[model samples]
Target: MIAVVYSGSHYAHWRLADRGKTVASFRTSGINPYFNDEKQITTLLNKNINLIHHAEQIKRIYFFGPGLASNELKDIIRNAFLTFFKFAKITVAHDIDAVAIASCKNTEGIVCICGSGTNAAWYDGKK
Candidate 1:
């Protein structure tokens, strides 16, 4: 099982999949470690316990958010997921990395992201 998430300033969307097919999806407040604290992010996730049920089945999680600008922030988000999806392997990264990976995979190429803001990069396929 796998989980994928994309977060912006306003919302964070997540989807759980099994064998490449989507099984469940949920949304919580944007778990941006920049503006919102761990308590707030926890509140958002707790608000939807049903979502956590699906999260439990996930073995891997790829979380991307615009606010993950530092390792400290990444740790915050990672810890939040750990609170619920206790056994899942979680990977948190900036939204820009999400954009680049989504478009180019592990190949060298140029990628551009135009979400709430704009960014462009030459990705060597790594985030």
Candidate 2:
């Protein structure tokens, strides 16, 4: 199973999929590393029934959010997920990276984001 998450300052959107079919989709409180610690993040995860039920079954996770501008910030979320998702290969990246991938996929394209903040980037199919 694979999980994809996109978080802003106010909410986190989650999608769990397996065999190219969606298993579940839901939302939780936002997970901004700058505003939340590892324990807080883990706590949020623990409260969600969807996550609790699927945690052990998920094999991969892709998380995107703001405030992951540095490796240190990314580690905050990574560490929290690590504690909860013991068997998954987790990836943490900037929310803009998500914009890139969504707009370009495996092709070259430019993406512009304008929500709470504004920025643009060029994706060469591989970041």
Candidate 3:
């Protein structure tokens, strides 16, 4: 099973898939490592019924969100997810990387992200 998450400042969108099919889709309160601690993140995870039901079954998680540009910030999310999804491998990255990959992929291009804030990056086919 795999899970993909995109988190902004206000909410998180989640999709769980297994055997190439979607199993569950839901949203949870936004989790910003910059503003929320491990305990708070864990609490948020615990509050979600879908997560509580599928946490153990998930094998991999790809998490992308804002404010995760630094290793310290990334570690905060890594730790929280590691503890919650015991059986899953968690990969955390900045939202900008997500935008670059989704929009540019392997093509050299400039990607602009406008959300709670605006930013842009140049992708040379690979980061």
RMSD of 1: 1.7
What lDDT score belongs to each candidate, Candidate 1 first? 0.81, 0.95, 0.91
lDDT of 3: 0.91
| Per-model TM-score versus the true fold | 0.88, 0.96, 0.95
Query: What C-alpha lDDT, on a 0 to 100 scale, does residue 1 get in candidate 1?
Result: 88
Give one clash count per candidate, in the order shown.
0, 0, 0
Name the candidate, 1 or 2, with the larger TM-score value: 2
Q: In candidate 2, which residue ranges exceed 4 Å CA deviation?
A: none
Instruction: For candidate 2, write residues 6-109 as lDDT tens digits.
Output: 99878999999999999999999998988999999999999999999999999999999989889999999999999999999999999999999988999999
Which one is best on lDDT? 2
**Residue 10 alpha-carbon offset, candidate 3, angstroms:** 0.7
Q: Please write out the lDDT profile of model 1 over residues 12-118, one tens digit for every residue.
A: 89888899898877776677787887777777877886565775677898999977768998989898888877779989988888888878889888887777767
